[model samples]
Target: DGSGFLAIFIIGMFVGNQNTRKVSYILPVGEGITWLAQISLFLMLGLLVSPHNMVHYVVPGTIVAVVMTFLARPAAVLLCLLPMYFRRYSIKDLLFMSFVGLRGSVPIVLAMYPVMDDISNAQLYFNMAFVVVIFSLLVQGACILPVAKFFNVYAPASVAPISKANVGIMLNDDFDLFNYKIKRDSMEGRRLRTLQFPKETAVVAMFRDGHLMKPQGGTQLKKDDILSVIGVESDEIALNAIFSQDKPVKQYPLYAGDKIYDGHTPMTLLAETYNFELTSFEKTLTVAECMSYHLGGFPQPGDFMNLINARLVVVSLEGDYIAKVGLYLLSEIRLKEHRRKNARSGVSTLSKYGQKSLHR
Candidate 1:
């Protein structure tokens, strides 16, 4: 416990890796503490610096900033990540990682020591440190995304889970808060008392037209209304079945060459056919319309949509509408299982269909 910072780091890692219950409980408190610390640190550092005095050392400060940004930081990153050694990381990845070594409030905070001790070149060093921090925050920080994209390290688009509930409250680790928009026509216009949610799950709060109301048995739900409920994880599927507009596709009787749709199917059918549980927003829209809605206009070939548990690429287009959709399931275990099952049965199923078509 010589350094409180090191002790905190160790404790954080221990709790994060080993104690799921403790982690969930402490996460809110830890976040508040972290934000308060960050704000206080920046405020103290700002009060300690003098902008007019910094201008006098601008030349030397800028030179140091250039060296740190281009050489020193990159060298440190490459050396530390040397274990990657061309196996997993390529040159572009290394370069991008190096470019992102941003200096923050910590370095500026450290620089305050020299000024307090009245050491030689103290003011100049402080000024240079301040300059480097600004350069990192303003310049390097801004370019981080673009640079990552250039190196192909950026993640693809997907349905983002903004928050689990209207107000995330973990009561005793026995239940989790799940936020859902009332989408299914069946659930809309129904009273909370009549719907009969699971015994363990309870709707804690409801948001209607941007207003938060504590839900009671008499509360009636409508489309676009958001409900934050606390429930056990195992009961989630049952809850989703009620509130979600999307229905699970029956895996039974699905065979190769089987047409899922004989006529026009909603674009969202791609989700059901591919075994994806659609997000509340993904229901009802045709594939073409969904694409256009998401992409800001008509989606062309190569445009992709990321749903909660699935990824879709527009494989083909028929005049401004999506004709063929390619689904990429995000779960590795599920993907392998599906592939194995389909490959085993696909050959026989296709042969039967092919024989009938040939005879005709």
Candidate 2:
């Protein structure tokens, strides 16, 4: 009744909500403390367990363990995760999770309470709990890796830095410091100047084998060298590509306005950029001029002209002229409809433009 579990849980909730930035610092220390506490708990519980008494209950205890491991735990896991099946969780993943639900020191610790209270047959309860924990550790724990492999859920281990510390600088919400370790035969033997990092991102510092070094453009990167990079959140994908063993894929950042072309932009350039079909006559005109010709009147905001495989929607108006136009492929329209059906709130942006389509 006086267990500190609830109190500690409440404290953890408060700290997680209020001081998340400090949690990273607390984790390494908390992990060490947890290991020590688990060791002490098991040792104390072991002293109370009698081999002869436990042997008498082995058959029943094993039956309890078998029912819990194969039936109860799996049913509970399936029930809990059934609702999330649409979230890309396959049957194999759920099965693997069910099998690996290892019983640990908590049950034995709970069983000790009745013994301390001098309840009748409390020693039997403790013995049963110890057997369950031993069975779980020896059986489920040993099979975890094999089950993961059978489920095709095992992934190749990636090389990670020996140590990482968040700088916790509140500069810009979009920008932060990222740490990367140079992989062997990957980014190693390359100069910093040769790396094609995003223009907005830059190397701020370098650490080699636990020693701090100033990062310079001419400095050669070595295996296991840790680099502190300052970049926006979007730059992480490109950074990972650069540091990975595989050839980097070209990445382009598209802004919301990129889909909406300026009305003053040349029709020929837009046609070439998006591979839109344009007649020789239409290529000579600007986007606004072409749209106005097709409309046969003044173009206002929310006017759209259907193209071969895409639709051009007028985004905004400057006086009587089209100011901005959005291009949406037929596939994109269907995708947006699917998202709107699932999310129910994704149509706000398109709804602002009204329901006007111009067919030529």
Q: What's the lDDT for all of these models?
A: 0.62, 0.68
Best by TM-score: 2
- Relative to the true structure, candidate 2 has a C-alpha RMSD (angstroms) of 17.6
Local accuracy of candidate 2 as per-residue lDDT tens digits, 233-293: 5677777666775453333322123387888889888777766667678888888888777
Put down candidate 1 lDDT per residue, 80-155, tens digits, no spaces.
8777866888877878877886468579678888988999988777788888888778877888888889888896
Q: Number of clashes in every candidate structure? A: 2, 0
The candidate that achieves the highest lDDT relative to the unseen native structure:
2
Off by over 4 Å in 2: 1-14, 17-19, 26-29, 171-183, 190-201, 209-219, 230-360
Give me the displacement of residue 30 in model 1, in angstroms: 1.6
